[model samples]
Target: MSFPAELSAAAQAVEARLAAAIQALPDSRVRAAMAHGIHGGKGLRGYLVLESAALHDVPREAALNAAAAIEAMHAYSLVHDDLPAMDDDDLRRGRPTAHIAFDEATAILAGDALQALAFELCAQPEQPQAAALTLKLAQAAGAAGMVLGQALDIAAETAATPLSLQQITALQNGKTGALFNWACTAGPLMADADPAPLAAYAKALGLAFQITDDILDTEGNAETAGKRLQKDAEAGKATFVSLLGLEAARARAQDLITEACDALAPYGKKAESLRSAARFVISRDK
Candidate 1:
């Protein structure tokens, strides 16, 4: 299958796994909100997990679990990120935000539950690499990783001066790059192989992904983006496009994509899917 087709297949498998797990929970408003939170995403991170697993010859079942875990974690982040205290947006994936779909309290609980579920999936007894994956996941999603980036972002909003380009880049490394790091390294981690190559690739891919997001926010239609656009500009926040002109930002993203693909050299032709994924990151409109 081609890259997009493979990505879609991976997404479908991961979503199914997520839905089944959520379905097993007792019916409640929180459960409903959790379901809503995980629905309708691109599942890019999950695809990366599966792809990396394939590259390392990890078992399909274990890869699916890992993929589902990351997707759940990502969904939880988005759910909370849309809260009134955070980014304060409504639309997500062209639908109402979880807080709007349910209530603020339910959304918060749902996010918490989803986060817990992520670890649960990672630590399942059947997986041989469960312990290592769980430990790394905690580190990646905790204060040292995604949360740290978020805290930095919130701090930047009230700082005396705008964040410098370097500062924002550091913030994004945690906020966005951490999970990408985990996803890309998962296969190697599961297979007990060196993860350096994929980790390097993920670093570049994550930065490119965020730069493209900044570009989209600057020039994309809100409808096409499935969320608010120009939010950074409206809030007077600095971004890649704000720091670098549009042409420059686009060029930078392309350069990062190239770097990401170059990092895949160890796998040679076997990594074309990843190369395509790197290209897709910069080309996507939403």
Candidate 2:
């Protein structure tokens, strides 16, 4: 299957920006570790930032900083999530995870430093909307968003009953959807334009992404996934595939992808890359 050239270009641009941003950090083992964590990925969130910014005619100077910042933040999340206390993974991106490559202390510090750098980059945007952008990022990654979702996930393990569908949706809306929302609407937000359409797109795309993740967990191999798979089942976790069954979950993801594309109807041809991204969410192997 042919992937869209536009998305590939956007991903490359974001990857370069992320690398440059990390290279500018002050020299230290932690800095090196931070760079290591940021290296290599599909770079979907950062690509969304750049593409959305382009749609709104936001300059590269402003968009690059925001794009790099989001990737930095995402890298931090993965580093921490792979810790012994969290997802407890030893592999990521087909290599040893941060904690495994470096010591636990170094990995912890890498995550902390990368997270700080994310805000620093956001603060330096050429546009005057730096403050607003930073605020949204904080809200998305903080206790009100991704952290809240993770906390809910951890707590759910101890609950006597499994989380309901509604409960899971609410949790994932923060954990996964919030970043997508920020990425998809970043250009509009920076330009002080309406974000309703992109927000609607992200809501559907993010859910589809998570549902596919659940499906992958059930049927994917760790080698292709670059990390453990089927662990959700091993942990007896509630997931879309577990709740809705395999075919149902796949159908639901397809429906959501269609919905996400529909949300971009106003943008027409300008949103074709974003539409491709929505499809990629479900089709990715890792």
Candidate 3:
């Protein structure tokens, strides 16, 4: 199958797993909001989990939960990020944001539930490397990583001066790169192998992804992006594009994609999907 097809298949499998998990919860507005929050994403992070798992020869059954867990965590982040006090986004995944679809309270509760569920899924009794994976995830998602990046981002908005390119890179590394690192390394952790190569790949991929995102915010169509675009520019915030300029930002993203692909050399041709994914990262409009 083609890379896109494989990615879609992986997404469907992860989505099914997430839906089943959510369905088991007690019925409430929060439950409904949780479902809404997880719907319609590209599931790229989950795809990374499954693909890296494949590279490590881990069984799909063993890895599916991890993939689902990452997607759930990612969804939760988006739900909360779209809250009134955060990015204040009104649309997500081509539909109303969770806070808009449900009430703000329900959205907050749903995000909280999803994040808790992510840890539960990763630390399931029968899961391989359950304790290790859970610990790593906690570190990746907590104050040292994603949250720290978020705090930096929020602080940047009010700073007297725009952030430097170096500062933005550091912020995105924590906010975006941390989860990608976890997803890529989860397979190796499960198989008790070295995660260095995929970790390196993820670092480059994550930065490239953010650069492309910044580029899209400047040049992409809001209708196609399925959310508000140019918000950073409108807010007068510094971004990769604002710092590097459009052509330079695009070129830098391409270089990072190459670096990401090069990091996959140990897996040889078996890693073609990941290579394709790297290329797709910069090419995607959304």
Candidate 4:
């Protein structure tokens, strides 16, 4: 299948599963908001889960629930990230953000509920590796991972000086790379196979992904980006683009994409779509 097709397939599967899960919750404004939160985006994290699982010959059914789990967590993060106390954004996916569309209180509740549901899906996987998967999910989403990254980002805004390259790298690893790592490695974890190669791949891919995001923020159309852009520059925040210049940042992202593909050596041709996905990361408009 073409890379776009595969991504669509992954997104479709994950969305269906997520919809079903949200439908099971008791009806309320928060439940509606939860549905709203999971409504859109590229579904790259969920795609990673499905593709990695396919590489390991893990059954899709076994991994589909896990795929949905990560997407739910990602959605929750975005919802909270758009809150007034966070990025203070009023738009997401080219629409009113969760907090703006729903009441702030409802958005908060929806985010909280989505987060809880992510753990539930991971922990209740029909596969035998439920405990390990659950632990990994918590580690990625908890303070030591994504939350830690978000905290550092918030702190960076108030620091006397802008974040250095190394500091920003660390922050991106937590804020963005953590989930990418989990997504890329979940297949191997499910198969009880070694996750080292995928881990390496994800490390490079995550950084490249963030670097491209930095690039997009610099020159992307806000309408195309479906959210605010250039906020970093507006806030005087340091980014890969700010530190390295656009040409150098783009070069660095290309280098990392190559690194990401190289790390998939063990899977040989089986990883073609994954490689394509890496390439797509830098090329995406939004």
Question: lDDT of each structure?
Answer: 0.93, 0.87, 0.94, 0.93
RMSD for all candidates, in order, please.
0.9, 1.5, 0.7, 0.9
List ranges where model 2 is wrong by over 4 Å: 1-5
Residue-by-residue lDDT tens digits, candidate 2, 83-138: 99988999898889999999899999999988898899889836548899999999
Better of 2 and 3 by lDDT: 3
> Which ranges in model 1 have alpha carbons more than 4 Å from their true place?
none
Off by over 4 Å in 3: none
lDDT of residue 84 for candidate 3: 98
Quote the lDDT for 2 in model 4.
79
Residues 26-124 of candidate 4: C-alpha lDDT, one tens digit per residue: 889999999999987799999999989999998878788989999999999999999999999998999999989989999999999999999989888
RMSD of 4: 0.9
For 105-177, candidate 3 gives per-residue lDDT tens digits of 9999999999999999999988999999999999999999998899999999999999999999999999999
Lowest lDDT sum, 10 consecutive residues, model 2, at: 1-10
